[model samples]
Target: MLDAVVVGAGPNGLTAAVELARRGHSVAVFEARDTIGGGARTEELTLPGFRHDPCSAVHPLGAGSPAFKAMPLERHGLEWLHPELPMAHPFPDGTAAVLARSVAETAASLGPRDAATYRRLVAPFQDRWDELVGDFMALPSTALPRDPVTLARFGRLALPPATWLMRRFRDDRARALFAGLVAHVIAPLGGVGTSGVGLVFALAAHAGGWPMPRGGSQAIADALAGLLREHGGTVHTGYEVKRLDDLPPARAYVFDTSPSAVARIAGLGGFYAGYRYGAAAFKIDYALDGPVPWTAKEARTAGTVQVGSSSREIAAALDAVSRYDRAPDVPFLITAQPSLVDPGRAPAGKHVFWAYGHVPHGWTGDLTDAVERQLERFAPGFRDLVLARATAGPPELAARNANYVGGDIACGAAAGLQLLLRPRLTRSPYTTPHPAVFLCSSATPPGPGVHGMSGHNAAKEVWRHLRARP
Candidate 1:
């Protein structure tokens, strides 16, 4: 019998399989879709020559992930292409605040009023990314922190609501940029640990940069699958597992899926009934004739751009979705222009751009007009460059990937205590009531993003359980 069986071939699932195989365990993965990549996949959704990342485009956390760093994914054809600037937050006045690789440049963009504040905020954890990320991503039961002191210091600042954290900045520019970061996870600015979400993104940019794969986001997944095969791990695609009996018998079963999916498939009925899904995303992929025309020059070169006029506006937009259960009139957009740095994503001078705004969970209304309007605010005449566009609402997103229940892309809600103690309150978040079953989806700790740490952490538990049985 196989040592482990991983269901779902998402980054987390594939990473778990690779980790088990590396440890000399026999492993197999079954995927519902014909191809892998889950949220990390790429396709020609708009025009034939314009390759778009339906979900994730720019990856900041992926570049800085300890789990990915431990693997030799680079040897398997994964190449990261960095943009001129990691990210930029543009205003209506055509000036922008940027998250550059250099902290100084980023601080300078915030202007003298809050430059020192921004510098001081990130100073405590500077140059300690390896230890910080390792400790931050791993649970206490799975791994001991390499640097406990730094981790504690970071937690103290990161545990508060982003609204409180924003008070530290004197100017609106600094607050607006930081607010945009917190909104990445679709959490309200007032939510606990929202500060950490923003801080993590900023620090990640400074440490490793927000990068895209040389070709598309799919390269990350293909590399993981290739490495798994090399290690004797097998992957079976187009094989959906509706129940436990559908999968081959194994010593352990790791699910890289939502909590509800695990409960349903594994027959642990109502185990995850309390798990709450949050706001959904209305995403658009554009096959553009040319690059996005940005009023701020920094946005034209940056890999990611935040389109919100002020901190108040960003907060209201998030509040509208997370609390009011309605689409905001002016949605705060998080956009990426991968073709800016990776020309291979499109044909000749053409470009592929992605943008998404938060909406109420299970929202079915069209967000194309609202999304394009927001883009036009920061990137004037943006609609003029679009050759074709593909839009996905909550229903379409959930249909494409089951993990995205109700279109909540972070997998589960990233708010309250759930933000840190996810899936449940237990320290062993990876383990379920059934001793042999484990979960490694983004629904677990360290929350969402393309980082494979969730799978990396889950594999540690599966191997330990396997060893204990024998």
Candidate 2:
């Protein structure tokens, strides 16, 4: 009895509902879990009074999210808290490389030798960030971009292996910093298109200081849900839709669940079934008595700390995850110290730490000690600061959110052709063979992140198709 029915109340689902409702269409969203925000969910996973984001904690994409920017989330109570610095990568020699809001400051932190190259690398779109990001963040297009030359330049830099991209830099600090950014891509470092992933994050960090929600990432979910309700859309929590038959009659259906879930539910055999999931994540949330005693001063200030000694070491660890299917002895850590900016995340005189490392897909590996070991390597006495720790290996992460199939948090792989032609290489990636249904999760283009581009794009197509109806 609705114009559109969205299954899954994650960012994509909620965004689709809002988009449909905004265009004068009746919409409803159904969520399997009691709470929303698939990757963006937050909870007191550790001890009570210590709020930790179960999956996605930092928000480079969220802050620069075009879909989120279009909505009135600020009115619905969404605030982004930016640390003094966006990111830091500490080396073995008690030194650090930091990325800050200012490009010059960031380059200075990279060291004198690499400073100019760092500037040249990121400064192309620095002046035109607002103009460049919209096209970059949207799904790939055959159509001409607003800035063709800039896009071409970026593609040239982004299309290579991350190792090749960093190879230009002579200093280990600069290479390591860039490699750490690439590691967020959740693929092998030497993989083609890995450089693009790293460049995008680095550019985004400079453009929009990687921030977190004031309270927790849950605020992002709550704001989206709240906005959806304001537009006369309904959200039914604790309601799981196994198939199209389970849903109330609607003209169109958009699924924000994983490709595997859709394939099973819709009986789409080869296409969706063949969609590959990338590396998984083994996460640990800690309630700390004090801030991590980081040896490097930059690590003490930055919200994100990449705990890998150098690019070579990071590449080896990434290779281990992508090829060997085993947990690396010294895994790369992407850590968030939310308490630095948002003190309310924990109880008085306490702090919260969010961190995760890449793991082989569907491989169950214990990396708690490995994570702690790396933590201690960068921050001496890190073990002593922990009041309590909550860990989620591959199985636990996937169990908590179906979108994270095998704990691959980016939803689907962003490697090679998969980056653009996700789920399948159809002209209309969002729309299935069935015109009435569409795939609107991160499995689509513009890949993953907390941004709602997949849902936004899918809703536009669905609206266009439905509008053509008599």
Candidate 3:
């Protein structure tokens, strides 16, 4: 029996396996797909020599993650490339809200009142970015920063609804940019615990500057996989463990999958009994040729672009998502043209644009036309840029990685009562009720993103248990 069997070679799984291997344990990772890197993958879909990131494109978490930082991805062919402007919020009127590498520049562009408010909001979190980041990324039970400064920093931003906070800012541009980042919470914009999503990302944009991998997100995943292999860990692809019996016997089994998959694979077995399953899934992916061709000049410079015109527009779109329905006509979309930052992504002048909008749980709608039409609203003649498009509806996404049940990329809901209690509020978030079984995927707390803290924390927990064993 191997010391550990990580089921899913995603960032979290690979991180767990690497830690276990480093700790002198025999570890093996089983991936459902032939290719590793669950969400952080690049493929040549639109055209030859055009590498597009399938799921997650721009990674703010990747730049700020403690686990990934400790891994030193820079040493392993991960070129951290930042845009002159971190992100841009282009208006229908052709103006833009650009988030520069410097927080002052981004805030100042918002006018005096917004500038002061923006600084005040993010200032407290600035000094403690590292701790706040860790607390946000770790599996809940990992201690929140004991330092008063950091604690205050966390509370100031996390303690309000995003809608409530947006009202405090005077300028529309600044509010929209912050709202765009917060919309990633995957919950209703004004909903509980949703505000923290805004602060976390806003702070990250200011601190680490939201760097992207030069080639693609796959580089980071590939580096993690290479590290796992270097540490004597084996990753088996095309092996889907439908049941516990299907997996190779190992002392510990860490699943990088959703709660539903966990219940099915392990037969509930008193392991995931208490958790409810009502996660909101989505169908998301975008394909485009050349640039977005936004009327706003700054949009061409931003790595991330927020499409929703107003904060209310985004809030309403999110409100639709909460009702388990698709947003009307123009949905809130987080679109990124990675080719802008990494020229290697496209051929000569041609580029690839990626975007995903909020949707209902288990939604089966083919959103290709809906999404394309929406993009055309912002970037005129966008259809002309579409060389090809790939639509991973909820079911297809769920089928690809059981972790993303019903195409909920988060593996579970990111907010609400379960935000901190996800996968439960135990001292060790990864350990399950079943003996030596663990949940290290985004399904666990600090839910979702390319941050490898979930896996890192899980490995540490299991290491302690293994060490204590006679």
Q: State TM-scores per candidate.
A: 0.99, 0.97, 0.94
* Alpha-carbon lDDT, every model: 0.93, 0.86, 0.77
| Candidate 1 lDDT score relative to the true structure | 0.93
Off by over 4 Å in 1: none
lDDT of 1 by residue, 1-470 (tens): 88999999999999999999999999999999999999999999988888999999989999888888888999999999999999999999999999999999999999999999999999888889878988998854477788999999999999999999999999999999999999999999999888989999999999999999988989999999999999999999999999999988899999999999999999888888888999999999999999999999999899999999999999999999989999999999999999999898999999999999999999989989988888988888889998998999999999999999999999998888788888888868899989999999999877798999999999988988988997
The collision pairs in model 1 are none
| Poorest 10 consecutive residues by lDDT, candidate 2 | 135-144
- Which consecutive 10 residues in model 3 have the weakest lDDT in total? 277-286
Native-to-model Cα distance after best TM-score fit, residue 357 in candidate 2, in Å: 1.3
Cα error, candidate 3, residue 141 (Å): 3.4
Candidate 2: count of backbone clashes, pairs at least 3 residues apart or interchain: 0
The full ranking of all candidates by TM-score, starting with the best, is: 1, 2, 3
Error of 1 at 16 (Å): 0.5
Q: How big is the positional error of residue 384 in model 2, measured in Å on the Cα after superposition?
A: 0.8
TM-score top scorer: 1
- Candidate 2 CA-lDDT value: 0.86
Ranking by lDDT: 1, 2, 3
